[model samples]
Target: MARSQKQKSVTPTPPSQLDRFDEANSARLGLICVQERIPEDYTRWDIEFLVDDRPSRLTCISPGEYGGVPHGLDGDFATILNVMYLEQGAPESGIVHTTAYQMLQRAGFPDSGQYYQSLQESLDRLKAATYTASESWRDHKRQRWTTVKFNIIERITAETQDGLGFGSGTTLKIQLARPVVESIREKYLKPLDMSFVLSLKRSLTRSLYRVLDAHRYQPSMTAEAAAEFRINLQQWARECKLRETVPARIKRNLESAHKELVERGYLTSVEYEGSRADTVIIYTFGDLPATTPAPEPVIEVVPDAPVTDALRRYGVAPTVARNLVSEFGESLVTQRLEKFEAMLKSGYQARKKSALLVDIIRDQGGKYADPEGYQVEPQRSEANLQAATVAKRMEAEEAQLNHRLQEEFRLLDHSEQAARALTQVRMFVGREVSERTLKTLLSAMTSEQVEPYEVYRAVTRAASELRLADFAHELRYAYGD
Candidate 1:
């Protein structure tokens, strides 16, 4: 009677130590196409996503080299996705140029080494990202379904000259992966609200926003499979990828995230009850704008609409569809709905479903293929002179484009250059240099018609005068040498 097996003792991490998505408003919902797993729960990391639901999973490809995924927060990659959309106006061909300062400003990241370093991680993650989807959407060329894989960014040109991060480089560009570019070209991508996504402050809270954004009207907060826990605490913890097992602390974080959502007007009400073994979390997606919401979305309690089901299957009630429509154009949302219908017709079903989905946009729908670090060499015939000739022509085109952009940067006026120079100064030391002083120096540079290098020197001088010595590293980039 006294024989008891040895129980494994588990150490819990604190909330402060938990990893979260700290990147500003970057959760892109394009990978929203996986199905809920069957009744049996696999890993917490593996949410029960239903095929009808169109749940997406983002597999990180070693984030430490780029400085790790936003240092434990979610949404950094999403932010990169959004920024790319803003820069390229949706995955266009070839390379698209955008300053790190511009990207950082848009993503709500301060112009600092730490955040820039984090952005680097995000860049690395995107360059190496592999997205998988459960439901298939129709591409312009072909109708696609599950088991497709692709990278987000093909390559990134960021020069950390003098270690000034991605901003100081004379050139900065992000190349969207071919498959992703095609998705954008074919109108399969979902549009996320830059302001709303950026407004979310926490990883978990933002997760809810994403899930809710995918759903419409009142989405189901019910368990994915009939046999799965409706909302088990332990399962929920795993879905959130929380290493912290301390019950009291977990409760605090949960409550805090929930409260933040309600206060921010994303959810009308959230209730968690029942025992840990058998629990349920009810979510009521509140109307952000009660006046003119899209026709009351029919709550099918099924994955009827890929974009809507992507969030609703996980109990997300998206309240931002209209805002997204007003911004990203209506065609994108319509495409998501079309994908949902196609999946339903194919009798497609995702055996696995995750409980959490961002409620930021039900209009955005996407697909993911289970592909690893996307790189496939094109087959070349022996002595392929044609390929070589084409490559040279493309290279020539790129050089011409780069030259044009550089010329534009070089000839910018005082106001524009001053603004850009000020951004650069702040990039090194969190904007420690006074704007007025930097402006005065930049005005002199413009007035004297100084070279770009001279402008750099003036900024350096102004920084030193202002007692901001940390910009010593940024000084090296003055000449673009």
Candidate 2:
């Protein structure tokens, strides 16, 4: 979905995107908080995340034209968002200038060809990816859990140099989604050092740190209403939002992050729950939470009084003046106004400055189409029948899977048979069943081993698929279209 071409200089961006903000504490806790690794040959990852004690579920979709998980530079995008916040304050929308090299350095990424490629990859993922959450809590209150699904990066502007690569003054214009703006305004987010999150390699330690950091609303495990909880291996995996990796591997990676964080002083200690030998819980959050917070961003301020005076003297409307501040920033606006003064001194009519200035500002910045305006059309190959057929077939398959699992449900011990049955049903079903459907089934199951469900649905997906496929074949044979 990401498109790129060489440009000599950045086109000025429109002001509609000034309000975008980074994923601060308010936004962070609600996310999956872990990388959904791109499988070896696959470009897409269908991931469902649930924190053990949290009531909501976040299903992350890193969908691209060519499917794949987001790269390390995806982490860098968060830093870029914060940079926008710092540069413009709480702007509604506008462009900021800098090269890819500066962004990599700012995010603690190595400056190199590999990283540059990754930067491009990450931007593609961010632009195309979207997440759906059910009653997901945002803000410090954690009480306003509601449904939301949107991209973190609304739009990006990267210019490629002719013989060189990405160079200086490449304007990155971004628009933060509505929910993000509200969270940024409410100050519901915790601040993390971009360097710290980028420091850890892709593994459980990385995810572990995020999970712990997400809990800084209660810096101490003993703090009231903190998200601290007891969990064995399975629950820990779910809570930390790790992908479907082996339990032993997830535990070891967590232990690795544990040791690293403890040595770095982010954790006072990471220990097993004394009463429950298998349970792991955080006992402390080090001085990380108390670090200096970023200064509030000023939204579209006229930083220069002299420029304001000049605009007022020229008879420009106050609202237009404010919008000019937003579009060009105080410094740039001041510069533009000074240019107007120079034009007047050189003999242009004073009365014409405002109209001329307005026209000039509008013409230079390339108009930006709404970022969310694009969507991928659903595929319709022969195998890809209508969604209704797919659903009907799936229902029939699940019905059969249940009936068969129930026949053998009595053989297993009582840890939980339902979970295993659901898992088995997935095995019997084809991959065509959307990940969203699988996520729903997973949410209903407990942390115990997958079991046969307590009961099977009466309708059968196998019969339905057979009937639909046969009907389609018969029609095709009769009308050779």
Among the numbered candidates, top TM-score falls to 2
Q: Any runs in candidate 2 off by more than 4 Å, and if so which?
A: 1-22, 25-27, 30-37, 40-54, 64-67, 94-97, 137-143, 163-170, 194-207, 218-236, 273-283, 288-481
For residues 1-481, what per-residue lDDT tens digits would candidate 2 score against the true structure? 1112222122211111223234453334434334435454434333344434556665566654634544433644654665545444343342343455556555545546766766666666766767666655453335445677776667776655433344322224455555665555444444444445545544344455556554543421122223233446545565454554565566565676677666665566665653333655544655434343333323332123344556766777645766776666555555455455555566665457678766545545633221233322334322342457646755765565445446545554443344333333333341334445544544444443333343122112433455434433432343223
**161-258 per-residue lDDT for model 1 (tens digits):** 45555553324567766555544444443334444555656545555455444432122211111111134565444445444445445566567667
For each candidate, the alpha-carbon lDDT, in order, equals 0.43, 0.48
Q: Each model's TM-score, in the order given?
A: 0.47, 0.48
Q: Each model's number of backbone clashes?
A: 57, 30
Total residue pair clashes for candidate 1: 57
* Model 1 residue 121 distance off true place after TM-score fit, in angstroms: 2.4
